[model samples]
Target: MKKVVAISIFLIVGLASVQAQKTAKMEFKSETIDYGDIKKGSDGLRVFEVKNVGDAPLIIEDVKSSCGCTVPTKPEEPILPGETGKIEVKYDTNRVGPIRKTVTVYSNSSEPVKALKIKGTVIDRESGS
Candidate 1:
């Protein structure tokens, strides 16, 4: 009976530790990109730097964009602790006026999911100049 109780406690503690380790912890330099002004019909690219601050390896599953006008690219391999990765986003200013977009990142870290945003105002060359 004593052995059974001790085993159960050990198992519980072990499981808790494993669960904590599975959680992801990461950091991003900037969560939002502010493109003050962009000319209409122009294209621009922004890169967001990510770092792993957890004990376990960080894996980025995928990156998604809110609209077809924006494209996102993420790392294909696992990012070990203390390592850095990049999230590349491309914005196509096909339409005029103010624009706000979002990029969602799915990863195996503690947060599992995160979002980054970009905002700017687009103006025609005649208007901007």
Candidate 2:
């Protein structure tokens, strides 16, 4: 009888934990952003949409890129549940050639660690004939 009671309690706690996770979740519209083809020294800004699809507020602790060439800015305020937010990424288009970078996102959500990607090519300006 004691073993049965203990097992029942464990099951209840496990179920509660699962439900708690769903209460603080982050859902991003797209994890990867493609810049396509761009010219060197051209605009290098993009936005990634994210939503807090949970019951708790989403707090973004930090945002970082793979290298200095790529910079990502996180939202300054917490995002309430059912609300959307943006993460801005800027790539140094001056560096010509293929562009492949990753952005790391840290937030107080069920999925605390997230990775975003930026990819494309930066074509060099034509030289004077």
The TM-scores of all predictions, comma-separated, are 0.82, 0.81
Tens-place lDDT per residue, model 2, 4-75, is 999999999999998776556889999999998888899999999999998989999999999999989999
C-alpha root-mean-square deviation, each candidate: 2.7, 4.4
Local lDDT at 69 for model 2: 99
Superposed model 2: Cα runs more than 4 Å off: 1-22, 127-129
Clashes of each: 2, 0
Residue 127 accuracy (lDDT) in model 2: 47
- Model 2 earns a TM-score of 0.81
The number of the candidate with the highest lDDT is 2
Clashes of 1: 2
Candidate models: Cα lDDT each: 0.87, 0.91
Best by TM-score: 1
Cα lDDT of model 1 by residue, 6-54, tens digit: 9999999999988776554779999998877889877678899999988
